[model samples]
Structures are given as C-alpha cells and as structure tokens.
Target: MKFTPVSGSSALIGAVLALVSSTSNAADLAAAEARARGHIAAESARTMHDAQHSYAARDVIIDDDGTEHVRFDRQYKGLRVIGGDLVVHSHADGRFKGNSQTLAKSLRLSTQHKIKASEARAAAVAAHGGEAQKVSEKVIYARGDSPVLAWEVRVNKAQADGTPSELHVIVDAASGAVLESWDDIHTAAANGTGTGYFSGNVALTTDLVSGTYYLRDPSRGNTYTTNMSNGTTGNGTVFTDADNVWANGLLSNTATIGVDAQYGTAVTWDYYKNVHGRNGIANNGVGAYNRVHYSSGYNNAYWSDTCFCMTYGDGDGTTFNPFDSLDVAGHEMTHGVTSRTANLTYSGQSGGLNEATSDIFGTMVEYYAANANDAPDYKIGEKLYKSGTGALRYMYSPNLDGSSADCYYSTIANLDVHYSSGVANHFFFLLAEGTAGAGMPTSKTCITGNKLKATGTASLTGIGRSPAAKIWYRALTVYMTSSTTFKGARTATLKAATDLYGTGSTQYNAVAAAWSAVLVN
Candidate 1:
C-alpha cells in the first residue's frame, strides 16, 4: 500500500485517467485515490491481521467507462460482493448516483483487497443475531481484480412444531462478507385476517395465521419478498438486519392487520386491473406481496422491488398505522407498479412525476375501494393520524398544506418528491373530478382561480372515481413513462380518455377540461 498527493487538477486527471489508462500501475493509481478517499485510513488499517480485523471499508473502484463503483458504508449501503473484487450493487440506490463527481471518486479506487467471503460472512452473522447455519462458500471472480469469495448461508430454524424458517444469506464470494440476507421469522394465527388483494398476481396478505401482513411481490423469481409477522407490531419487519423500515402504530392495528391497509391493497389492485387492465405489478398476472408488522414502532411504509413486496409500519403508536389508509397502501403499491412498468428514475421532474403518480393512483385507489367501513376521501393520510389533524397529502387542494404546491411552477423541482407531488395530484383531481364549482360531490370545495366549486361541475361534476380512475390507469400503466412530467401527464391522461371513450365523447372532453382547470395544459 502506497500513498501519493497530486494537485487538485492532477487528482481530477488521475480520477479520469484511471478510466482510460491501461497500465500495470492503474491499480496503484486507483489505490492512491482510494487511500485519499479515506477508504483505508491508517488508523483503521493499523491493526489489520495482528489481532482483530477492524474493517472500516469504502468502495474505490472506477471502471474504464468512467462509471464509479463505491462501497462506502454511509453512502452506498446494501452492496453484495459477488466474485473477485467484483461486488454487486444490487439496490436501486447503489446502482445510480445523481452526482457525477461522487461517482468519479468511486471510480478511482486503486487499492486491492484479498478478503475471503467466509470471514466476512462470519463477521456479519456475529454482528447480526447470529442465528445462521450451513454456511457454504463460493468464489467471486471479477475481471482485472483479485478474486472475492462468498458464502451462501442458511438460517434453518423452526417453530415449535418444526416448521422450517428458511432464511437465506449471500455473502461476498471472495471474503466471507455478508452482502444480503432474508428470513421469515413469524407466522399468522389466521389466514384471512391479514389478507388483502392486489391486481392480477399481486396480493397483500396479512398473515393473520402468521400474525403478519405481507405485500406479495409477484414478480418472477420472487426477487424481493418481505417477512414481518413478528409476534408484536414492529417486532419483525426486516428483510435483513441491515435493512431499516420505519414502522410504528401509525395505522393502528394490534397484531391484527389494519383494515385500511386491506382496503388500500384491494383498491389499488382493482384500480390497476379494472382501469388499466394490468395483469399485476409485473403486468404478468403474478401479483405483488405486502407485509405488515415490520419494524418496531415503524412510521413509514415502502415499496421494495428487491423483495418484490410492500411493507407497512405500525406508525408512532399514538398517531397512525401507515397502512391503515387506503391511499397510503395505494401509494406504496403504486411505487412497485411504477418500478416494474416505467422504472422511473426518482430525480428531477421524473422523480416528481413518480411521486405524484403514487399520490394520484393512491387517491384513485381510495375512491375505488369505497368501503362502507372506510369512506372514500380525497385527502391522503386521512386514515393515518400523522400530524393529528389531516391526511398525509391532499389532491384537490395541495396548498392546504403549506408544504405542497397548489399550482405548477418552475421551483416545484426543488420541493421534496412528496410535496412536489402536489402538482400531479392536483392535475389528477381536476382531470377526473373536473373544476369544482356547482353540483360537485366533494365534501370540500376546490378553488381554482376566483371560482370556488364543488367536485361536480356540469355533467363533469358527476363523473365518479370509476371513470376517472379508468382513464388515469390507462395513462399511468400504458401511456406514461419514467421521464413523464406534470404537463406530459396531462397530455397522456387526455389521450387515454380519448382512446377509451370516443374523442368526441363527454369523458374525453371532461379530461381535457380538468387538465385545463389544473393549469397543466
């Protein structure tokens, strides 16, 4: 291991050159950058092999194409070492970086590590609960680097009657590094208690039998699955010990699966199928899966494509069950639908649209799931008592929250994805529900311009959630893409409506008017 200091310009040159230079010292140059990046600080590396392997690691590999491969703990977490020096950046966050300079820095990793997969796995297992067994080894051979070994360990524990709890582990092939791990710990007491349905193959099953609720990932090969039926709420909701899912009593279900979650899942499932005719999240008839009772006191829910499942948190106990709202479930599950279909990159306008898409569909799902138990509402997070006041989001009127946008503006990009989502949410509301003036069905009035109106205006005011959802579903699943913006969404939905009903039909005209009302067109 050697160190060299270069001018700032030279550092940039070296970082760039590491990509093009095909010399034997290329690794040295990369290692120099890695050393500079504090990948292997002397203090951390000083006691290597003498006693304990105090491993504080960072990724410092820059490829010839200038793509950076970083393994920083704080940044690029959840990367699994496959073979050789090659570690697989499996998570979506790991694969892409919005900042190129940060990426460039990762590319300059010149240092080589000779870590064995078995050792890394043992360390990881010990760090975790250490309930692992049958640790098998494999080699991770990457091009132009030292080989990395990995271990495929299994956690084969059983319930009282010996029902196997099959847990899987994928460690660094070269150095026993635990890259990823998953296990199903608890089962539900009743089958139907936690069960909800998603479109086509996707389903949200609260394992009342397993005492958990699951968002099934109906994608092929069962990539990302969630197992969270811990005996107590929030007790068991992690796919891996390294995973963090925000769970609390937000939706407020005991060990019993929250009812709103079931409504949301069912509605979202129905919306996609009935409206867009999507077979499921994957559009292949295979359904997605959901799991409840994830982490202890978890407050947020997430749609994980890696597990092909959706997860809900109990919320802050005193507040809400994140899953107890139809809109929330629709929102999370829509994320999965977006991932499988458009694979929207969550940044810029695309990111905003992606977030808005969730809000839009979630709202649509709410209306679709018009259960007598949970009346359909235009408000988001209404069921979950987040702020102890209103829903998590609002579509008809975004400015209702000081945080969200009421109308489109250039600065919307700077807003959080959720807040910026207001634009799209508003657009959807206006499109289907129309400008609320007179004769609207809304409990609340939408004030656009100087006009304060109900949800129903003219015959358009009577257009219920079903028709509007149908058109929007078509736009989202079939017409919209990852790059869609607010304006683009308007056009897509209008086109969808026209295609569904004749262009001359009132429905198409209504969609057009709604888009106009929202000022998206």
Candidate 2:
C-alpha cells in the first residue's frame, strides 16, 4: 500500500524537495550520488497510492551506486502497478515532465499492469528444465517482492508408451523465476474448475483422505507420504507434476498432500472469515500463495514472509506427512497471519507461546474442516506422524507424545519451541475445559474450588469449544504481545473472558479457575 502525499503544484514541488531531502547534508560526492538515486525512487512513488492493494510504503532507504548491487538472475519483463500510477524515470530519452505520457505504453507507467500469467509460468518452467507447451495452466495470482505473479502449470510429457508424465511448475510472473515445482503422476484426470490443481485426486466432502503425493520436474522426482501408510489408499499425488523438497531430504510419497494442504488453507481462510469476519490472512479478501512438495524428503513445513507463501513437505513415511495434515497447514499459515498482525518472535517463552497460538488455531481449523481423511483431534503435530498410534503434540496432555512439556516453568524457553509449546497448550486446555480427572473427557475439564472446598468443590464445567475458542482468540489478538509469557497468557485469557462473558459469571470464573489450576499466578 503506497501513501501518496497531497498532490498540487506545491505538493509536486514538496515531493521534489522530499526527494532532494534524501541527501541534503551529505558531505561527499558519493553520498550525494547515493541520495540522488534514493530520492528519485521515493519521488517516483511519493504521489502514488494503492500500489499492490494499498501496501503502505515507509522508511525509504537509498543505496549508493558503486555499492556492489546484486540483481536476480531472471530479467524483469515490465513494471505493472495495480490500483495506482507507476511513475517511470526514463534514463534514455528526451526531456520528460510531470505526469508525462509517451507514445510507447510499455515505456510509460499505467494505473494497472496486466501480464500473461500463463506465459510467465511457462518461461519459468522452461528455465527449470521442463517443456512449456505440454503443461496445463491453473491459477495465476500476485505474490511477494518485485511484485511477483505466481502461476500453476501441469506437465503433459508422455512416456515411452505415449503415456502422460507428471510435472508442475509455480512460476514467478515478473522475473519468470521458477519459484517452485512438483511432480508425481496420478491417473485421475483434471477437474474443470479454478485450474484443476488438486481438485480431482482429493475429495473435499469434509472427510480427510491420506496418500502419497508426488511432483515431477525435468531436474528430479520428489515424493511425499501422508499419515496414511496402510498401502491400500493412495492420494495419487494430485499435482502429479509438482515436486516436494525440504531442507532435510526427500519427503515420503503421499497423495492428497496437496489437497490436504489446500484444504487446511481453505479452512483457515473460512475460520477467520466466518468466525472473526476477516477476509484473509491480511484481512483484504486476497488469497495467499501455497506450495506443496517444498523439498526432497522435507520433514517440516513453513510460512515464508519473504515470499508471502505457505509451504508443506512430506514427513517420514512411517511417522507422518507433515504437509498432508490440516493442522500443520493451519499452523504454518497462521505464522503468516501472526507475522502480518502481531509478528511474534520464535524464541524464548514468548516464542513458545507463539508456536502454541498456531497450534491452537491449527487444531481449530482441523475441527472446522472436519474431514474424514483425518479425525480432528485437539493436538498440534499429531497427524504428521504415520504411526497413527501416537500424537505429535497433545493439548490435553502434551507430554504424553514425548515432545511437549506438560507444565509451564521459567525454564520452558530452554526447550525446543515445538516441545516448550506445551505450557500454553496446557493453559488453553485448562482455560477451556477446567480440572476434572475421573472420566478422562474428550476435552479437558476444570474443578473450581469456592471457599476451601466447603461445598465439596463446585466444579465449573466448560461451555464446550465454541465460546472457549473465542476467548482465546481475543486474548491473543488484543492482549498478548511479543513479550507475553505463560503467566501473561493466563491473565490475558481471564481478562478476555471477563470482558466478553462478564466478571463473576460462570464462564469468567471458570476461566479464572482454569488458569489457577495451571499454576499461573
């Protein structure tokens, strides 16, 4: 979002002054030259607003020429600014004036720029050692820095028997950068709607399906497996053309991983929209980019602020496909959402809380999607493991999984962020359910002690997950911050519940007892 200063004759002059102000006090010619370039760039956008859907521009910094500038390998085709004007500073030309119009549209700036998403995708695929013509096209949406455009394409290469081979490309529209690709040949034909990327292979009827997902590229073959390793069912790798790669190695082959990834994303989008009235992650009704089969044998998934996209990878086949699970997708994508909003740090106790917040929302999305492929459980990393016998992390008893800590302590930060997340997880469970021991309820329960157990401890039962989740969300958004700790979380939730339900109310008092049971002062 660009911020355009008020425009008038004087405003134009003021913009020029702002441009010149970039380096007025520079002592050296080198510094002056650097500021000149910086001023021009800032001045270029000074009078323009609504660049890339109102992405505000601030803290303009200019680098000195001869400062060893680095450029991306792919060349820029053109500059397209949406919702505002793009002011170009022509180096090779006769005199140009303010708001000048040229005979060459390509040379001049326009309100919005339209590019061939398919063409750019093909170029990126070819750059990555794949044929462009044989690939089928899908969604082409705008993405991160340099105003990138992302396109999906499926490969149509035939084998020796004239059978179609699997391949897919996610190309960058502006620089034609092959951002990522996937491959795994599924026999299912493409479903006609919104590019048919993963719609055919994975069922969306709210039941979760698990299988091996694969991606093919001329460079190499990448495969990943989901939680289902029974060998009878196969997701057939919906993309058939995209590859999965992680920092560790090749992830197991699992079908419907893409569908799972997309499903998780859809659920998250809907949860925020229907539950919180948010349009998308940024609350702008814009779709975010998602990449499945990120790396070979990749054991983890991540949300990248740089690319503004979410990536998933298959897990160890025997344990899980970290990408195919709904909670995992929601967890990673929530990192993106959190970054856009609270921008939580991934370190120390606050970091543990950050991770736990993702788990909280992630698990919520799972239940929201409520697919049959995987039953929604109040656990964070559970579905990623193929064992199916054990959960990755549990909210009720996080320590049971062997990774998470059961209780919060000052030293919680010393534990792995994933493992340390237990404290907050447990806190949330207690907040929602309270302290009840005998029955081992599907959800946790709380025992509220009023007046030293004179009435045999009046146990305040929970009002189910619906209202509980709202309290947690409100606390996270309105009260919690980067420095929030376990105790802070306790206070935040109690405050949120009291604000929403009223003080001394059963809901508010139950929330208070839940925190006390968790040992949060």
Candidate 3:
C-alpha cells in the first residue's frame, strides 16, 4: 500500500480548524450555562431556590431559533441533593421563560448529622444483605415528603448468577434508618432476531490501528464492542482483525456476536441522530462501549450508567440466545438515554414508562434497520427464544402476556415495572398502528374503571409511526420528569404533539385518543 502525506501548511490548517471547532462548542456551552445561571439567580432571589443551593449545568439544548434549555443538578451546603434536578427554558436572548422541575418547594432542610458515617453504612449494608463493600458515601438531601439529610451509600456485590448487585442505599443521616435502596444495575432481558446471528450481513465502520482492524465504530461516537471471554467482571478486550472482514455468521466465531452488538449499536445511534436530532446517547456526541459474552450462561443484558456502556449475556440456550439483537441493542442503549435525560426514577409508574420507552424505541430501531432477513414486529425480546412466538411482552395487546395491563388500573403502580409498562406500550401502539393493523385487535375493549370502553365505532385512528415516535421523544426529553405518571405522560405527549404539529391538529387529537384508548385519563 502507498500513502501520500499532506503538506505542512495543510496539516497545520487542519489542526487549527479542529481546534477552533472544539473551542467553539465549549464556548457555546459556557455562554448558555452563564445565561441559565443568571436565570437561576433571579429565581433564587424570588425564593424559587434556596440561597445555599448551587447549580451545575449538565446539558444544553439550543433550538433552531436559538431558544435554550439547560438542565441542572443541585447541591446544598456541600451536600448533593437527589431529585433536585431541574431544566430551565429561556428565550433566544437569554430571558427566562419558565422551568421544568419536580421540586415543588425550595430546599429548607438543615444539613446536620446525628449519626456517624459508619453507622449509616452499617444500616445500608444490613438492608442490602450483601458483603460489606462500601464504595462511597455522599451526604445528600434526599427527596421524600420533604428533603431530609441522608447518606447516599454505594455497595458493590454480585448475585450468584453473575448479575451485579451494585446497590444505592439511602440511609437517614440523622437517624441511621434505611430510608430507601435500589440496585444500580438495571436488567433488560429476553429478546432479539434473523439470519447471520440476529442481524444479517451488514456494513460496519471500524477502527484501523497499526495494521489491525477492530470492531470500533468511529462514525457513531466511537462505539466499540469488546469480548468478555465469558468472564463475570470488568470490560474485556476489544475485538480485532488483520482483515477488515469479520465472522462467518455463526457461534464458531465470537466476533459473530460482536457483529450483532456492533450493528445494533450503530443502527440505534443512527436512528436517534437522524430521527430526533439527538447527537448521541447522552446527546454529547460521545459513544457508549459494548461488552459481548458477559459471564458464563448468563441470560440477561443491561446498561450501567456508572460505566456508561452496554453489556450483553450469552444465554443458557434453552430460553434465549446471545442478547445482541438490534432491538436489544436499542433497548439497552435507550436505558442510558433515559438515565441522562429524565433520569426517571426506576420504580412505580415512572419506572414502567422508563421500560416502555426502551421497548418502544427498540421496536422503532428494528423497523429502521428494515433488515430483509429479519421481519419487524411490536414484540419485546421475542427473537431471543427458540420459539419465535415467545415474546417477553406484547405491545398492541399487552394483556396477552397474562400479567401486563392493557388498560390503566388503580394498582398499576404496584406491579413490577416490566408488567406495568404495558399501558404506555399499548398507547404507543395505538398511536402508531391503531386497533386494526397487523397483529392488532380490530376492536380493543377496555373498561378498567376508565369510564369509556373504547371499542367498535370508538376505536382510535393512528396518525403514523413517525409522528407518534416524534411526539413520544419530545415528551420524554422536553416535558416528562423523573416521577411522571400515565396521566402526566398523556399531558406531556399532548403538548409535544401540539409543539410538533398544532393545537387540535390531527396528530394532537390522535395522541389524545390513543391515551384515552389505553385509559390513561
């Protein structure tokens, strides 16, 4: 091979241009953040925030006409405040328009401690019931009926089956009481498709370093897949090849699985950027890495915010195959998106919305791929099973899963988030495909105390998949909060439709009717 080098002047010009571009982005973010801080200062003077609270900008969204939305995290008296995050919306000229927040009141709690840090750690350890591995502790003001002093404890442990038990336990700093605890590890399991190991033979953009081609996507945020070698811990090696070509579409080559993950991640990246104008998973033009062959006979896949990456499992072969399907990739990556945007609390109605958001986007990614070998459908994790019909959940009619609710119910919040997600899934399906499409019920009957039983002549008319997805994405990023409910989702999506289309437009009406069909009102 022969190569020609650019002249010194050309190379210097290229370097200077790259430097200017990088500096411009940083300067833009800094200016917007300054404007947000000014707005926040005005609000604090007006008592919307406490004088002791400090705001740090995490994200910035600039509209076509220059309107800005700045997302911020809060701290008080040198202690982090959980659930104290908020978004500030401003006019093109930096005038504060309004804000999106769940903090109904300003922080007024005293930052005093009655219990020792060791005692709080002990309480967290006892509540989690795992080996005492104290990762870190932050004295945080946790949100509840009111903000209270607490210790946000991190614990590291593993379940017997190799699943992570990285627990985030909240212990009351004043009483040493275990207030709340949740696993940081979120699992999305059981589904994917087609010939050539889930995704068909496809093109990939890889990294060529020192005469070796590696499965790293340089185009899409540098997302690369690694080989775990079936180990239970740590990021494994990045797959490399002398020739750019990869596996022969079988398990005989581990890179086959890597191909599936790589393709999935790439397709998902393109879907979000092209469809919604999102730059990347975190909307920062950076990619999340992937790990294939995680643990021996593991049957699950997950996205860890702490690591900012996607991890896939090689199934036991009885229930699922390797979880590297395109939808699986989309689903897992959406979890990261959810964490970065709304940071939806992973419990109750919001948790279900979180899961459903992944399912909805994953299905969209599958369709976006338009793979000839793999057919598209509105089923969650269906492709993982030996039997094609064994989907983890159904969207058009979630009740077919036996546990998921097809309509909103009073106790829906008490169900597991995976099952409760049925309501949103059903709503999205009706909004996109309506009650009379492929694999859909011609008449969807629901009376779970929602008054109107939408069926027969009252069935909803779908606007289209593109509009429906755009509305949902708008709602998710621009309107929904950490603790949004089904009713709130209805409102958010309605507003989103109005913003995208117009008030009382067909798309807006369809969004309303779809929510009504699912009994979210």
Candidate 4:
C-alpha cells in the first residue's frame, strides 16, 4: 500500500504522510481540518435542527488527488451521540462534495426526561439480567426514522455464568422504553505459569520497580501480567516478588501461570514486530497488560478494547487447564489488533473473518516461537483440552471438530463466527501448505470427503508460511476494510499477493487457487 508523493505539493504530501504514519496520535491535518469544521457546521444545520447538535473532527485524510476526508464524532446537547458519526468528503478548493453518515434521519428529539436517571439505570440492569454494580448515563441520539432522545446507560456486573459483564443499554428518556442493549465483553469460550500447561518449564522477564521484581517485561513496551485472584472484574494485583524467579509446577501457585502468559505475550509481540512490522497491538508501540485467573472456574478468555487488555481464565482445572497457552495468547491478542485495524464486526461472515484472522496469526505466532513443548500445529486451543487428545479447531480439516465449516457455502454466513472461520482457515492452510495428500500434512481431506485439490488444472504448490503470513498481514492491514466480506477478502488477499510477489507469480496463483479450493469464489 504505497502512495506516491504528488509532485509540486511536497508540503501537503509531508503533512499527509505524517498523518498516515502513526496510529498513536491524531494527525495535524491543518488544511483539511479547517474545511471539515465548516462542512460539519453546514451539514449540522441541514440535518440537526437544534444548535446543541455539533461535531468534532476525529480524523482527517488528504488523498494524493487533493481530496480531503474528515471523520467527525457527533454530539447532541453537549453529550456524545452513540451512532451519530459521519464522514465529510471535500475537494481541494474547500468545496463540499458529499458526506457519509450512520444516522438514518435528522436529529430532532424531545429533551425533556420523563424517566429518571435512576429508573433508566434500573431498566438497564434489568435488561442485562444482573444487579447493577455500576451505572453511568448520558444523552444519546437513538437511531430510527427520526433520532430520539435516549439515555445511554452502561451497567457493569457479574453475568449468570460468573463472567464479568459490561452491558450498554439505551433507554428512551421520555417513554422509558428500552431502545437497545449490547454486551461489551467479547468472550470466546475456551494460560500461564511457573510451569505453563503447554510451555513446560520457562524463564520469565520481569521489571525491577523498586526492590521488588514484578511480572512485567521492560523490553516489549513494558508489557505486564497480573493475578486476578479468582475474581471476575477490576484490575488485578501486579505479580511482585522479592526474588525475580516466579511460578512453580503447582497449579496452586498462580504465579507459574503468569510466567506462561508473560512468555506468550513476549513471543506474540516479537512475532508481530519481527514478521509483520507491527510494533504492538494498535501499532502504537505500547504493550497491552494481561490478567490471569479471572473468576473462579471461568472457562473463557477475552480481549477488551475498552481496557486495551487481555484476560485469561484458570478453566475448571479439570476439563481445561489455564487459557494462557502461547497460541491462545496469540489468538486473544490478535483480537485487539483486529479491533484497532479492520474492526470486522463480531457477527456473520465478517465475524468469521475476524476469528480466522486471529486463528491464522495465532498459528503463525506458535510456529514462530518454536517452543519445543508446545509444538506448532494448525490447530486452535489444542493445548487447552483437558483430555489432551482433541483440538477446538483443525485448520487442515475443519470438519474434524464437527462444528466448523470446511468450505464456503451460501449458508456459511448463518453459522457462528467461530465455526464459519473454518472457510478462511482452510483456505490459509491450503495456500501455505497445499493439500494434505499432495505433500503437506498427513490425513487431510476437504469438506467434500475427497482429497483437497486446487481449482482448475493448475496443480497446487506450497508457497510456505512466510509468504502466506505476509500476504495475509498485508491484506488485513492495507486492503481489508470494516465491511469486507469473504469475497472482499479474496480480492484483498489477491491484491496483497500481487503486491508482495507480483501479478502472475507463483504466490499470486497459489492465493487464487487457495481461495477457490475453499469455495470462496
């Protein structure tokens, strides 16, 4: 994704380049910024009746052709509007061209509150199926034929399954109607240690803050780990010790699991930096923190974009060990990366791509680490199984798991994202390793119960992991967009392969063949 500098516009090019260079800070888009504000004011007058409705510039991008795109965050009555964001496109002469908005209609709503804030909080808690531990309310523009005055109530509590909860509920301020609700916790029902369940015996990196050493890596953006102390929520205590050495084989010694988590985090960090040129999860050069032993007998781990952190569970300690295995950590952390980048929504086919992206990188990270005890394989959560004989997902043959779809179909979009992820997962395996019987892994078969074969008469040849991973990473970061579908993914990967290996090259052909093999065409 290289952009050529426009000749005679070195100053403007430098400004645009600076804006696109770092994801850490907002770009100082001076020229575009000024035009964007005026555009917003004019649009606000036409769309929103009240003077209270306004917009603040969130991002500005100036294309090489002299077009400017300004993204704005909307506010109503000085309060943030949840889904009122829009993007304004302008020409170089500061002339308004067009705008894209999430809102379906104009913002005109009654500001008078018929429902008390306390009542709205209670309604939110009731909708969340739990007692409210904490609740916050704000005015928001609720989407409909006409935007309506709504109280956006956020409730935090424990779920029925003992998982920590963060639910957002929208209640109509005048009618006290529950307009919408959503859970913030992203859990994938599935870590660490003095002796990690999979990493075997390992040494850990620590930060010596004061006289005590803590489970913090000073090298990787000061990445740190903490013990959740078997609770579901809140920032856990940072693991500290008089001696730098921590974690033993005993499951009782939770610090041992922290060792596995910390090690996994380090390896994942290294994989992104060394392979994909990503500095960290958000490409901000700042590391994310980890929390282990979340909740008693918790069976799932999750990544929270709100906190910019990852959480691991101890499992039931029977059916599963800790959820801090290297691949698991990679999987979870990749979720954060996806959120920061192509943020594929967590449902339907896009969600499947989201999960497959994580799974793909998770496998790559595992192989990159090359840990002897946890031999790398195209299997997700292979180490988390209590029996230690089965895997949660099989990339070589997704149907072996009995839930994941091995090939694409019209109905594949209807399956759960985790299950639908099989399509891309299998495509990736085929792209990297070719067919199972054709000289890659053993005992691999296609969704049709036949030997996996390439599309058309072209015989599939292995392109190896490095090229495949690079292609996928490039597609993910450069070509993929928020609403990219499987078909769009095919286009993205093809473009990526072309960029990396050139058009009509062996790698490019392999990418096309792989997608066809998975029935993505």
Expressed as tens digits, the lDDT of each residue in 1-521 for candidate 4 is: 01122222221122232233242234446667667666666665543424556555544545555766665556665566665655567876878876645465666555677888888888877766666545455576544445677777767776656767666678888877887654556665452112225577776778897799988888898899989898765889999989887867677787878888889899999999888767788766789999998888887778787787889988876777888888889998998887665555565677789889999999999999889989898988878867767777888777777778877777676787888888899889988887743445642334443322212333456688899999998777655644467887998899779867899999999899888777777
* Model 1: worst 10 consecutive residues (lDDT sum): 186-195
**How well does model 4 score by local distance difference test?**
0.72
What TM-score would each prediction reach against the true structure?
Answer: 0.51, 0.51, 0.88, 0.72
The runs of at least 3 residues in candidate 1 whose Cα sits more than 4 Å from the true structure, single-residue gaps closed, are 1-254, 258-267, 386-388, 437-462
- Candidate 1 lDDT over 182-264, as tens digits, reads 33321111000121221121233332225433432222223233446543223244233212222332223242353334435
- Candidate 4 lowest-lDDT run of ten: 1-10
- Model 2, 313-343: lDDT tens per residue? 5443443444446677677767766554433
Q: What does the lDDT read for residue 234 in candidate 3? A: 85
| lDDT (CA) per prediction | 0.48, 0.48, 0.76, 0.72
Evaluated against the true structure, the overall lDDT of model 3 is 0.76
Q: Residue-pair clashes per candidate, as listed?
A: 100, 67, 1, 10
Please list all clashing residue pairs in model 4, or write none if there are none. 191-322, 191-323, 191-324, 192-257, 193-256, 193-257, 193-260, 194-247, 194-256, 194-257
Return the lDDT, model 1, position 374: 55
Candidate 3, residues 1-521, lDDT tens digits: the string is 01122123321111111111111375666666667767877776432575566655556666666667777666666566677777777765868877776666677777778877778778877877775554445555444657788877777787666788777778888888887665657777443331223776899999999999989988998999999999877899999998999998877689999999999999999999889888789887899999999998887888898888899988877657887777878999999888877777777788889999999999999999998766777877777776555577788877676777778877788877888888899899989987786665564746657422333345667877899999999888877777677888998899789878999999999988888778777
